[model samples]
Structure formats: C-alpha cells, structure tokens
Target: DAMVIQNPRYQVTQFGKPVTLSCSQTLNHNVMYWYQQKSSQAPKLLFHYYDKDFNNEADTPDNFQSRRPNTSFCFLDIRSPGLGDAAMYLCATSRDNGNTEAFFGQGTRLTVV
Candidate 1:
C-alpha cells in the first residue's frame, strides 16, 4: 500500500470557488506538511502539523489554510481559489526534523479557471 496518497491528482475549479485537498499517510509519522510548488520554483511551505503543533510559513497567503484532525490525516483548504493558486499541492510526511527524510505524494494539480 502507498505510504502517502492524494486523490484526484488533477483538480479544476473556477475563480473564487472554495476547494479542499486531502492527504493521508500510513507511516504513522507525526509530522505532516502541505507545500505549494509552482513552475520551476521551490516548493513553498504553506503549513505543517507536528503532532498538534501547527506551523505556517510567514509568506503564505491568508487564502490558504490547513487542518489536522489526527495523526494520520490532514487537509488543505482554499477559501477562494485564484489563478495564482493553480499549482501542484504536495503532501509530505517526516518522522522529525533533520534526522529523517521526508516522503511526498504525487500531488494535486489545481487549475483555477
């Protein structure tokens, strides 16, 4: 079974519409992260949850947010999708900080119309 998985590898939406992308891991890892990566750009950390500790990147936009109800699942919520929000949304998991390597899911490619 896949350790991490994202459904609907591609998603399309109209401008100003709300959308939710989900992530799940079977590794029992405590750290889960959501990153948005644009063309050729580094994956920018939107937010993460280390157990129940939520960490959001300073530059992340207000339109983006995340949720972690338990150790195995997390979700990214976009209140109002914009064209600029169209990018690859990656979900990752790690055991901890520098000691472990993070694993990523294929990602959901959001296309805002």
Candidate 2:
C-alpha cells in the first residue's frame, strides 16, 4: 500500500504542553504534508516538504512547527497545546504538490487536558 504511517495514533497532553507527532512513508515520495482537522471543519494544510523545500500555509499558526529531516520521515511539533488546539492531526504524502493524489495516515487524535 502507498501508505503514510503515524505513530502513537492518539495523544493527550496537558494544557500548554508540547507534543510531537511523527510520520513515515513507505513509498518514496517527493511531497510530504501535515494537516490539522477539527470537528465539523475541513482539513487545513499546515505545511509541506517538497523534496528539501519547506512550504508553510499562510494561515497556519506559529504554535505549529514541522521538520522533514529526510524524505521518508517528517515530524509535526505543537509548541504549546491549548484547548482550541485539540484535534486530529493528519500526515500525508504525494508524488508532487497540490492537484495530485495524496495518501493519508489514519491520523493522530490529540486531546488537551
């Protein structure tokens, strides 16, 4: 399967705590992305790594950070979690940027305590 795998499928952090979510792709892809999805809302693109370049979405919050140390792996770090930041974090991969087929992991559900 052309799959993206996310670790520790669910996470709960104390308010203002820092948390990091990880993703690894089985398929060798050029584009890896991180998105945040809240209940009843669309999945919002936070950032992406196209090869060695990093692209951050305009409206993505400063609290969100990402790192692509290598093509096969990426990391999403939430600097400080808040009640409003609790949501499902999705990791995805594609051959290229937008307008292409992307495969997503099951997602990590983050809860703020």
Candidate 3:
C-alpha cells in the first residue's frame, strides 16, 4: 500500500537504553508526525515535520526528538528511555497539516525491560 510503514512492530529495550523508531511512506507526504500513546490515555503529539521545518509540542519532553531526512521518511529517537516511556509510538503523514486526512502506521509498541 502507498501509505505509512513503521519498522519493527514491537520493541524491547533495557531500562535507560536509547531506542529509535522509524516511519516511512510512499505517498510523498510533506508532513510527518510522531505520537506517543500510553494505556488509558489519548495519543500525545510529540513533534512533526512540515517539509524541513520541525515543530515540537510544548508538553513534549526533551527525551523525545525527531528527524525527517526527506518527505517520505521520519525518525523518532528516545534518548535514555525509562520504564515510564514504554508506550506505543505512532507515525503519521499528510499532504499538509490539517489539509487532508493523515495516514498512520500500525504503531510500534515499546517495552522497557
């Protein structure tokens, strides 16, 4: 399908270890977003890339960082992930922010061990 694809449907990392989740698409969308969702909580938008411009949510912790090397790809880097950071990380893309429906991947579930 010509939509978003996330690598490694699940991940397990040791406590305090760093982890990187990846997202890619064939849609050539210009905006890519990264979100975190925990049990019983709504998905939280961590940051997004509109082309080469980066926008991070104010509430997003410094532990979260993102990179978009091109229009079809983005990466989420969790530096020194803690047990509390275990959650589902999602990747989504749209032609433009709020201009069209966003396409999402199946999500990468992270577990801290």
In order, what is each prediction's RMSD in angstroms?
0.8, 1.2, 1.0
Q: Can you give the lDDT of residue 6 in candidate 3? A: 94
- Candidate 3, overall lDDT? 0.91
Q: Which candidate is the best by TM-score?
A: 1
Q: Estimate every model's Cα lDDT from 0 to 1.
A: 0.94, 0.93, 0.91
For 45-102, candidate 1 gives per-residue lDDT tens digits of 8998999999999999999989999999999999999989999999999999669999
Candidate 3's TM-score: 0.96
Order by lDDT, highest first: 1, 2, 3
Which candidate wins on lDDT?
A: 1
TM-score of every candidate relative to the true structure? 0.96, 0.95, 0.96
Question: 1-113, model 2: which lDDT tens digit per residue?
Answer: 63789987999999998999999998899999899999999999999999989999999999999999989999999999999999999999999877889999999999999
lDDT of 3 by residue, 17-97 (tens): 888999999998888999999998998999999899999999999988888888878999999899899999989988998
For candidate 1, the clash count comes to 0
Model 2 residue 32 CA deviation (Å) reads 0.6
Measure candidate 3: CA RMSD. 1.0
Q: Looking at model 3, report the run of 10 residues with the lowest lDDT sum.
A: 1-10
Q: For model 3, name the residue pairs that clash.
A: none
Candidate 3 residue 85 C-alpha distance from true site, Å: 0.5
